[model samples]
Target: MGEKPGQYLLWNELRGDWCNYDIVGEQYHGVAIYGLLPDDWSREGFETQRMFELVPEPANPHDRWAISVRADGKTVGYIPRQDCQSWANVVRRVAASGLIAMVPGRIYARDAKNWDEWDGENDPPREFASTVQIKLGDPDGALPINNPPTVPYTMIPRSAIVQVTKEDEHTDALLKFVPGSGYGTLFVTLHESVSGRAASAKPVVEVRINDERIGQLTPQMSQRFLPMIRHLASRGLVTACWGDIKGSAVAAEVRIDGIKANEADEVVLDGEPVTLPALIDKQDDPETYALPGWIDMAVQTGARHSYESQPESTTSSTPAAPPLPPAAWYDDPQNHRMFRYWDGLRWTEHVAPKVR
Candidate 1:
């Protein structure tokens, strides 16, 4: 199946010693952006306060990754030289998508903003800069779903983002370090493996922050969400919220109907919004007398136009192109057994839904 490129693999869902991790990716987190440098720890980084922009020289656009930070307007040295081109490419890919979206990032401390630490010049420029880390989204975001696209454990609850609409202590806790006004979705991850060790596997969903295991799904909560979690996970819209309810027991609340079919009139695949083609062609040239096959081809093209023509014609702005088709299940263009939904117009929310 054809997949968009810019997507960098952060990690995989494989768990336990039995799972082979033959893939070795850049040491950087998520996508192309790398992390806080030890020598660049002179100051602390802010949450999502300042926006970031990519600065590349026309001459060495790929080779140089000049990220400019807003606020006082500081230009950091290029990302680690080794990762400079890679990081630049990711930004280019995202920008090229033409989607106004946010990618994950982290700013590390620096010994001196002026000095180009990676450049190895003790005499750093007097300009200000910070080490920035870029992170990619789910590495397997584009992988084909296995037959029914089984998710070993329940996926994160997207509805949780709305059910508990307001920002609360729980949401704040997970994204405390992340800057800007942002929200975090609570997800359940497993903690068991084939070797019977503490690894991400099946069943028990784990909860933690910064590698600190804080909680797990309480039996009561699991029983409540198990079905919905499975159903939503299949739809590729699974979401949930977890918190310390009582005595370290993890309690969760989920909302299912957060998907506003209209919120996005267009479809977004791989973070890029896409327009849909007309399901039925409204206009075509009259069948050519030269070819007998032309007539059948035109009839087989399905309904050709909207608003059946009456004997008399009335003038109206070409029947506002049929209200974009409703999002519906269609054979997966990428994978055969796995069908994806054309939400009326664009690809969306695929899961273990029974295919007709």
Candidate 2:
């Protein structure tokens, strides 16, 4: 019989290992062994050895293999053919099964033990173990949030004059002066005389100096009026007051920068009225404000027809022509009405009046 199918051992040339054969009376099956070999026995070495032992034992061992060739005249160990195949199958099955079993309880125990041993007698703070927390609340309920109230402030010019009067028991009339680019004046009037009494019935005019408390004023015989006002004026302070006098007012011209006033029937500065005209001119001509050099030129040229000539259709009752074209219409400086003849270059002397 040829070498028994299952009873023989062979060297796996591809994997460089020895294996066993399975013989079912006639059929053959392969079995592999897990082991190492001397480096000199592999193809990468000398390639002189063709086979190696499958098992270390001889008679009736679990698996056995033959040494077919010796490369360096040295001998190694043996392996059981059946055991080789079984070992290979077990390795393959274990590799294919993806389940990896771990012991969580054991791992935790080990970690705890290691930690206790690594850090002794001291521990981290308890607060450090907890995370921080934040809470948001509504803003409108006495808390700072969106949409807070705002107060606005505006600056008044130093030149502006202000007037104050007692309008009623609760309110006072305030007259204010506004200045234009330079110095201005304001005037005020009193409706009733201040009572020269010490009783609370007298009106009180309290003046503040640059937001600092200075002094108080009530029309009284004991108080010095002009000296007090003069002192306040010299110090560049703004005055405001409250009291019982009606139609009582004050006015003055204060110097300030970058303000100009126009002539109007009534001028109100910072809510106070000014009666004086801010600008003045002596000329009576309505057109004087609209045209330049009009008055002087009118005297030189005399009144001329308003148009080029009377329309051919007009009778003796026709209106005169419109005035001559402006002096700018002449191309040359010498071509004034005194020098140039009309040659159709411009309107005829009959059409346009000559300058004297």
Candidate 3:
């Protein structure tokens, strides 16, 4: 059988022994960037942020755990040796699910120029090296589920779709029990290797309805999820979740509705807003297609308070200042005929003439 797309888990779920690492990558150790550095324009500017794609290089001679970082479709560097092992494992799991492993990275250089322009004899402008900073771990739980379930735990998060393989053998038996609604819950159990197959490194999870065996998770999947399934079994929790049965009795396929690698936690937003980043595609905007970027937006409104009525003082002695507004284009205080960009803090030079 062909390799099925791997299941996805939140960063927390992907944080275990094999892939639990976070570090700022070292770029100059082997001149990793070499000829791949950003163009002259970028080198002559301030720090630039890019969405870096992490590609695992199992065949790399120097380090089998090597992970190459790419930006704008060109190689920039590699994940530091100290963290690549765990990072590679995480990348594999993420890639198996058909999603690219990407993280935000900053490319910066000294003096904001390709080469030092200092002509002074004593303090010859410092080094001209460029470095990129990346963080693989999501320690603060900032990464949310791609498709959260309506009710947590009872069903898998909508993102994980588990299929019961080898359903051909059980099709006849499944006919009678298949409900008219075509939906039912299946109990998951990790069992020893099937009859003549090689003894698996980990136990295989079997999917069953009532007492009849329907099918089992593929060998590859069993190994991928063995860790979490074992954890639940150790806690004496019954592994059961919803599934949808489709196709005629001649040959039926069972697909898990949702599943989770870890148990869900209680979430309370209070009155604060939730903000998320998403990659956008605008048809009319051709530049966006050439350089796609994540769009950040507030998904909820904050609770209104009396403090909002108070005017913000540009110079205040009090340490407790109200939160800054989200980054956006607003009327320029100094330039009445134009609008400047506020990047959640100080005003930026980016501006547009006020629309009449």
Candidate 4:
């Protein structure tokens, strides 16, 4: 009656025929008849047959009224209603396995079957699954990506030469020679630990010769003395000798030799007297003095005036003129009378009296 509730009939365009089918349950019902001419089929040919036969006489009491279709009698499509409740279970399994493909704006027959296959090659190979091919800009030559190498150094020898000696009780240290490429210097180092501490911390004597300075314990002394040594050595006077005296009084006397005869008059020793020969050697009136070392002592008289009366002659021959008041009465500034009156041991307080 109403198209047998769930039975369906259709024309196959590829096969070119009206097909006859019944819906019994999940399985096919009575028999399917195909290749029916559309003009010869009754208006409700298969639908009228299924409602009376398969709907009322199912294989089991619960077998639903359903429609099944076959391409060449292998059942491929179905629809369920009424007595076939298990037909719903078959439709759910087909939907999960993707038996149907839905496209928008298209309609499909209720009994259309979906067939699709999946081969395993669309996935990556197991070994290379974790890797990917990344394209860098371009390829260059293979260069090392690590560290570099090392170099070496050389050493040279120093050039200054030095020597030390003892002259008398003092030390005569020398900076003998430096190389021609001379960095001309020699440092004289005295370890204070080895040489005992000085009795007086003050420098007793410090001297420098050649390119070396000796006996300088302080930095200020070394700076002042070392440059002096360099200057002296450059002048070719490289010898510096000194004497240390341990006595209460240290005196030095310098005797200048080979002095000219005229020059000797100007040489005055602090406490010594100048002799007559020393002075006469420098004078132009050489013949007026007897010997260069002697003094002329002869006395002369002046001519008398005849108009004046002469004194009377007496027995003592003028009474000796009272001894001329002794030559000490004449105050001659050039006589050096104070030296002449010395008694060989000490000076006398006597001075020659002034005379007109």
- Per-residue error for 97 in candidate 1, Å, reads 0.8
Q: Please, what is the TM-score per model? A: 0.24, 0.14, 0.31, 0.12
Worst-scoring 10-residue span by lDDT in model 3: 295-304
Per-candidate clashes, comma-separated: 21, 38, 3, 5
Candidate 2: tens digits of C-alpha lDDT, residues 85-117:
323221122112211100000000000122523
Once fitted onto the true fold, the runs of candidate 2 whose alpha carbons sit more than 4 angstroms away are: 1-176, 193-198, 203-356
The 10-residue segment with the lowest total lDDT in model 1: 294-303
For candidate 2, the per-residue lDDT at 86 reads: 29
lDDT of 1 by residue, 1-356 (tens): 11211211111222111212111122212111212233343444432211233323323443324322111112222334554443343333333332111222445432234343346745543332234444333322211111111232222211222232212335444333221212222232323112124584335333433333334444433344445434444545423222211111223332221222112212221222212111111112211112111111110011111113211221221111112333433334444344354544566675322122
CA error at residue 70 for candidate 4, angstroms? 99
- Local lDDT at 272 for model 1: 27
lDDT tens digits, residues 1-356, model 4?
A: 01101111110111101122223222211112221112243322222111111111122233323323222212222333542343322222222222211100100111212123224446422110000011111001011011111111000011111222221223333212221222212212221111236773442113333223333324432332344333333443221211111111221111111111111111111113211000111122222222211111111111111113322221111111100011111112233221122222333343322111
Top lDDT prediction, candidate number: 3
Instruction: Report the Cα lDDT for residue 194, model 1.
Output: 23
Model 2 local distance difference test score: 0.20
Q: Give the TM-score of candidate 4.
A: 0.12
TM-score of 3: 0.31
